[model samples]
Target: MRIFDPHIHMTSRTTDDYAAMAAHGVRALVEPAFWLGQPRTSVGSFVDYFDSLVGWEPFRASQFGIRHHCTIALNPKEANDPRCREVLDILPRYLAKDGVVAVGEVGYDSMTPEEDDVFAAQLELAERFELPVLVHTPHRDKAKGTTRTLEVVRESGLDPSMVVVDHLNELTVGEVADSGCWRGFSIYPDTKMDPDRMVAILTEYGTERVLVNSAADWGKSDPLRTYATGQAMLAAGFSADDVDQVLWRNPVAFYGQSGRLELEGADADEGATFEGNSILRGARAS
Candidate 1:
C-alpha cells in the first residue's frame, strides 16, 4: 500500500532509513521541527537545524525517491529557553518556504507557562500564515495535556480541521475526535500505540480523519511502523482502500491544507547537489 507518514524526525535518521522506507512503500513524509536530544544553546542552532529541514533533508530523501516535506516551529521543549525563543521571529521566513507544509511540533512539553505562551503564539502564526498545524501532546500527563491543548486550539479560533493533535492513544483519541480536529497516532515498537492497537482504533473509528505514522527519530523507534500498521490492518481484515485512506489520503487531506504538497517528481537523482554538496562521497562508482 502507498503511505504518507505525517510526522517523523528524519534529521536524526540516516540515508539507510530513507532507502528502507521507500522500499517499504513510504512515498511521502512530513518532518516536524522537534527537540534534539542535545540541548540547543542559541537561536543560531535552530537556524541551522531549520535550514537542513528545508534544504538538505529533502535532498537526501529525494535521493531515495521519497517526497519530503516539513513543518517549521520552535518546538515546545525549546520554547522555555530564552535563547531559543528568538528563533520564533525567524520562523515566518521559513513558514513562507515551499516545502514547509505546516507549523508544528508546537504544543505542551512540560506544560509550563512558557510552553503555553509559545504554543498560543505559534497557533496565531499558523492562522496568520493560513497553514495547518501539527500539535504535539505531552508524553507524560497526556490526557491532561491533550485536554488543555484542545482548549487552547479552541481559543486560537483556528478551524479544528486545520489542526492535528498527534501522539495519541485510545485514552486521548476520543476527545480530539469530538473536538473536530484530526487524530494522529504514532505507531511505535514500544511505549506508544503499536500496529495491532492502531488497527483496533481504526476498526472502532472507521478511518475518517485518522493519521498513523512511524514518528521515528533518534530514539529506539522503528521507521517501518507505518508499513507494519498497513500490514496489520490487512491481517485484521481491513480492505486495501481502508489502508490507503489511513496511510495516504488522510495525511494528504490534513497537510494539503497548506496548498504546498509537491507529490510528483520524487525520483532519486544521485547527482543532485544541495549547496554544492551531493550525498555521494569521494569518488564516483565506476
Candidate 2:
C-alpha cells in the first residue's frame, strides 16, 4: 500500500528509518516544524532547525526515494516563550521555500493566551501565503481544546477545509467532521490512537476527509505506523483503494492545496546535492 505520512518529524529519525519507510511504500511525507525534545534557547536555534527541515531533510529523504516536504510555523509549545516568539518573524522566509507545503503543528499546547495569539498569527500567515494548515490539537483537554480550535479557525475566517485538526481520536473526530475541517489521526506506539482504532474510525467515517500519519518524532514512536495502519485496514476488509485513500490520496489532496506538493519524479540530475554536500560518499552533483 502506498503511503503519505502527512505529519512526521524525520529530522529526529535516522537514515535507516527512511529506508524502512521507503520499503513500506511511503513515497512522500511532510515533516512539520515542531518542538524538539528539549526547549530551544533562541530564535537562531529555530532558524537552524527550519533550515535543516527544508535543506538537509529533503536531501536525506531523496536518498531513500521518498519525497520530503515541510510546514513552517512557531509551534504552540514554544510560542509560550518570549524568546521563541521572534521565530515568527522569520517564518515566512522558510514558508516561501519550495519544500514548505503548509503552516503547521500550530495550535494550542497549553491553551494559554500566548498560544492563542501565536496560533492566530500563524493563521494569518497561512492566509497570506494561501497555504493549508496542519493544526496540532492539545493532548490534554482535547474536547475543550478542539472546541476552541474550531472557534479560533472560524473566528479567523479561514476556511475550515484549509485546516486539518490532527491528533484526533473517536471523541474528537465527530466534531472536526461536523466543523467542515479535515480529520487527521496520528498512529503512534502508545499514548495516541492505535492502528485498530484508526481502522475503526475509517470504517465509521467513510474516509472522506481523513488523514492518517505516524507522527514519528523524538519520542518513542514508529515512522512505519502509517503503513501499519494500511495493513490493519486491509485485515479489517478495507480494500486496497480504501487504504490508498486514507494513507495516500487524502494527504495528496490536503497538501496539494498549496500547489507546491511535488513528489520527486525522474531526476535529470540524479546526483544533485544540497549546496556542495552530497548524500553520496564519492559522487558529485554534476
Candidate 3:
C-alpha cells in the first residue's frame, strides 16, 4: 500500500515525523509553499524559504526514504502584503526549478484585493510555464472563495484538468468537482473536515478526481493524517484499491504529470547538501 501525500508542509516538521509517515507507507509527498505560522518580514526570508523547499526539506525526507516534491507559490494570506509582492515577482525563476510540480496552494484567503492580484498573477505564471495549479479556498466565506477561484481559473484559460481546488467542505465539494477540476479535502484536527466526514463524502461522491491531504504545518495538525484517513476507509469496508486510489494513485497522477517527482533505488542516497557559509543549514546530503 504505497501512499503519496499530495500536500504537506514538511519544512515545519521534524525528522521523526517523516520516519513515522514513511513507516506507515507514505512513499512520496508534495509540499506547497504556504504562509509560515509567523509572518516573514522580508523578500530574503521568502528566498530562503524557497531554497528550503527545493533543498533542505527534500534531503530531510530522504533520511526517512520518502520522495519529496513541492508546489511553488505566494500563499494567499500573504498576498496582501506589499513587501511580500517583491518575493512574488521572483517566483517565476523557482517555479521552473527542479522538484516544483505545481504552482499552488495559492488562492483566496479573506478574499482580499491583494489575494486577487497575486492569485491572478500566479495563474498567468502557471499558464506561461504550462504547469498545473493547486488552489486553496478560503477557510471563511468558502463558498464565495471557491466560486471566485473557479472564475479566476477559467479566466486564466488553464485547462481545467490542470487545476486542483483544495480544502473543500460539503458546501463546495459539488461545485468544485462540477467545475471540471480536481477536488481536494483536507482532513485536519478540529478545524477542517473530519476523517469520518471525509469517508462519508467518498461514499456519496465515489472518489474520482479527488485528493486528500493533512495540510499539516506549524499548527495543531495530525502528521499522520493520510495514513489515518486510509485506516478509516478500511474500517468502513473500502477495498484496498479504494484507499489506494484516494491516497496514492490520485496524487501520483497529479504530481507525476509535472515529470519532476522520481523514484530512486530504495538504497540510493537522496540527501541534499548545502554550501559552506550559506544561510541554509540542515541535514547534509550523503
Deviation in angstroms for 76 in model 3?
0.9
Off by over 4 Å in 3: 264-286
Error of 3 at 61 (Å): 0.4
Compared with the true structure, what per-residue lDDT tens digits does model 3 show for residues 209-239?
9899988888999777887888899899998
In model 1, what are the clashing residue pairs, if there are any?
A: none
Per-prediction CA RMSD (Å):
6.1, 6.2, 7.0
| Clash list (residue pairs), candidate 3 | 272-285
TM of each candidate vs. truth: 0.92, 0.92, 0.91
Worst 10 residues of 1 by lDDT: 277-286
Give Cα-based local distance difference scores for all models. 0.89, 0.88, 0.83
lDDT winner:
1
lDDT of 1 by residue, 83-164 (tens): 8889889999999999999999899998999999999999999998999999999999999999999999999999999999
- Which candidate do you rate higher for lDDT, 1 or 3? 1
Model 2, residue 234: displacement in angstroms? 0.7
What is the alpha-carbon RMSD of candidate 1 to the true structure? 6.1
Q: In candidate 2, what are the lDDT values of residues 40-137, reduced to their tens digit?
A: 98999999999999899999998887889999999999999999999989988888889899999899989999999999999999999999999999
Q: Candidate 2: RMSD over Cα atoms? A: 6.2
